[model samples]
Target: MKLSRLGPVGEEVPVVWEEDRAFDLRPLTADIDGAFLSSDPVAQVRVALADRRLPMVGEADALRVGAPIVRPSAVYCIGMNYAAHAAESGSAPPEHMVMFMKSPNTVVGPNDDVAVPRGSTKTDWEVELGIVIGARASYLESAADARLHIAGYVVANDLSERDWQIAVSGGQWSKGKSGPGFCPLGPALVTPDEIDASDLRLRSWVNGEPRQDSRTSDLIFGIEQIVWELSQYLILEPGDLILTGTPEGVALSGRFPYLTPGDIVELEIEGLGRQRQTVVAG
Candidate 1:
């Protein structure tokens, strides 16, 4: 099922979205997050759905959709995971995985407005696959074990401000990446059974023109490898978000202009869903 949350920000109600219909998730859990995911709630949702215990959400068509999952505990990101994207930014693919993080608060609804930090001159866009952790993962020994800890996938826009991420901070990336609304996620949290992550068409747009067009197949480090490697280093708790990295075609590549107020940014991944956000001044 496509698990979603809709309504005003912070007042969102959980629901199971299937095609044109939405069913309330309140009967099972108050929210879709760390607690719910860890409990293997998909089985519970399936049972409730089978028994027709889920009621149709009211006025579902007009409700604002929030990020499918609640704010995660951490937003870990891999850098240089896409070879072409790495080369475009003047770097080589790493021999060892390179990772960084954005403050969890940076996450916002997929369609929410993205605020360009004041005085920013090089804000950019990236379309990526986001992994949502389902259970505690520590010292995982293999990809098979890592796979079991994943709750689902979502489309993520790993928005960046090159000026802050590179020009200052003496090389730390989170400084430029932690602006409010930097990580726009969701539309829905698709269960692992619903989609395949190995290869999906990942795309992005600015205003109405195409910018990034690539596939998850181009990832220098695949999904299972990313999760297993991360597990060896940090304790991944339920609901932690891991952005596997983005493909080429960002303003940072210098093939296009940086985002400005009023620019519309759209990102999508096959079978997962899409995200549309407007760029606004901070």
Candidate 2:
């Protein structure tokens, strides 16, 4: 079943999305966070649905959609995992995965407005497939082991500001990446059983024009490998979010102009759902 949170920010209640309507998920759990996911909630949701214990949500479409999961303890990102994206950014694919972090607080609802940081002229957009961790793991022995810890998948917009990332900040990327609503996630939190992440279409647009159009198959590093490798260096806590990297077709490539206030940015990943955000002044 598809899971989501709706209502005002920080007041979102969990719900399950079916074909025609949403079913209230609060009867099963208060929120879809680390604690709820670690309990093997999918099976529990199935049982709840079988018993008709969930009530249909009223006017769900009118409510705001929050990030499917709560603010994670950490938000990790893999950089240049797509070879074409690496080339566009003027680099060769690394022999080992490159990683970085975005402040967890940067996350916001899928359709919320995103602000271009003040005095910035190079805000860009990246569409990426996101992995949500369901179990804690450290020093995982293999990719198979890492796979067992996954909760599900999501669509993510990894917004960046080229100036802070490259011209300043001593070569650190997060400086440009941690602005308010820099990470807009969700519309749905798809369970693993409902999708195959190995290869899926990923696309993005700016103001109704197609920008990035690529596939997860182009990824140099897959999800399992990413998680397994990360476990070796640090702990992967439940509900942690990992952005699997974006494909080519961003403003950073210089083929397109950077985002400015009043621009509408849209991103999508097959099966995971879509996100649309309006650019606003910070």
Candidate 3:
């Protein structure tokens, strides 16, 4: 099942997409958040759909698509998890996962305008597969056990500003990653049963020109391992977002120019969905 939040930002309503139709899930939950997922959102949605208890909303295209989940506890990211991306950025695959955090406030509706932070020139794009957690996970015993904790997945654009990320601020990547609207997520939250996260094709384009084009199959630290490894260091709570890293072809690789005002960025993860954002001056 595909889940989503639709409407203007901060006023979105929970919704379910099935058979090419959108149905309001407000009768079941106020918002799709950690609390909602913890209550077994999939099973509840199934019952609602089967009982015909959900109200049929208009076509999904009629509403503004917000990020699939609201106010996620934290937004975590794996850096250089793709070997090709690492090579493009002039780094080798790390022996251990490299993790970073983005301010939750950076989360925005998939189609919203992305602001180029003031005095910025190196804003870049990363198309990644985002994993939404379903249950609390701590010190997971194995990579296999990690799969049980996943609720769903979404397409994500891990927008970055290379200048602040590397040149200034003493090399803390998160510095450039935490700007408002830095993370544009959604189109829909696809449940695990609906899509395979193992080897999906993910890609991105800037103003109609293809930039990043690669597959999750190239991930050095796959989904299960990312969760398992992260669990050993930090608790993975329901509704937490994990950006599983992006494949090669980002502007950071220096092949393309950094984003500027009026540029449009589009991202897609096979089966998860697509996202488009227009860059605007801050």
Q: After superposition, how far is residue 213 of candidate 2 from its true place, in Å?
A: 0.8
Task: Give the poorly placed runs of model 3, Cα more than 4 Å off.
Answer: none
Local accuracy of candidate 1 as per-residue lDDT tens digits, 1-282: 699999999899999986889999999999998999999878989999999999999789788888899999999999989999999989988899999999999888999999999889988898999999999999998978888999999999998889899999587999889888999889999999888888999999999899989999999999999999999999999999999998889999888999999999999999998899999999
lDDT of 2 by residue, 1-282 (tens): 689999998899899887858999988889999999999988999899989999988999999999999999999999999999999999999999999999999989999999999999999999999999999989999998977899999999999988998899697889988988899999888989899998999999999999999999889999899999999999999999999999999999989999998999999998888899999999
Off by over 4 Å in 2: none
Best by lDDT: 2
Model 3: weakest 10-residue lDDT segment is 163-172
With candidate 1 superimposed using the best TM-score fit, by how many Å does residue 228's alpha carbon deviate from the native? 0.4
Q: After superposition, how far is residue 234 of candidate 3 from its true place, in Å?
A: 0.8
Cα-based TM-score, every candidate:
0.98, 0.98, 0.98
For residue 67, what is the lDDT in candidate 3? 91
Tell me how many clashing residue pairs each candidate has.
Answer: 0, 0, 0
